[model samples]
Target: MDESYYKYHLFFCVNTRSDGGPCCGDSSAPQLRDYAKQRIGELGDAIPGNVRVNTAGCMNRCAEGPVLVIYPEAVWYRYQNRADIDEIITEHLCNGRPVSRLRI
Candidate 1:
């Protein structure tokens, strides 16, 4: 496995359920994931390998809906809006410091 492709891999759970089950999609996970991607792109040449932001199906943690997990460090976070995403990027991706307030 060529793990060097990206320094960090972020998986955002954007699962949607028509059965009215608790899901990340209900909390705007896709939109926030896009916001996070844009923010990472804005970093330009500041970081290491690419910080990949991807959408994922049910992570089986709907109770912690709107969740995202970061690789290498394997940190899990539950976010609500763009601000939270910004903090995650600035604190975690940029500074090598995970945002404790957002961690799940």
Candidate 2:
């Protein structure tokens, strides 16, 4: 297989369940997405180039809401706060190691 264009593609699920169902948005995923983006930007060359972070819709795992999935490995994770985001960025995106504790 050809090399990936991006080293890592991280998708933060930000789906909002209007029916009061569990969702990543219920845990402030949108804001966390923004935080990850801003933090990645701030890290600059500290983080490898070609790592993409984005917000996604329902991943059909709302029961495990506040989740993110990282590709090309397709590792899914559940996170709570900024610290978790930082750990994901540092351990996964920066160092090529997925944060096992956060994995769902």
Counting clashing residue pairs in each candidate, in order, gives: 0, 0
Error of 2 at 30 (Å): 0.4
Candidate 1, residues 6-103: lDDT per residue as tens digits? Answer: 88999999999999989999888988998888878988777666889989999998998789999989999999989999888888988889999989
Worst ten-residue run, lDDT, model 1? 42-51
**After superposition, which runs of candidate 2 have C-alpha atoms over 4 Å from their true positions?**
none
CA lDDT of every candidate: 0.89, 0.89
Residue 52 lDDT, candidate 2, scale 0-100: 88
User: Over the full model, what C-alpha lDDT does candidate 1 score relative to the true structure?
Assistant: 0.89
Task: Give lDDT tens digits, candidate 2, residues 1-104.
Answer: 78888888889899897899888888889999999999998998888868788888899999987999999899999998999999999998889898889998
- TM-scores for the candidates: 0.92, 0.92
lDDT of 2: 0.89
Candidate 1 TM-score, true structure as reference: 0.92
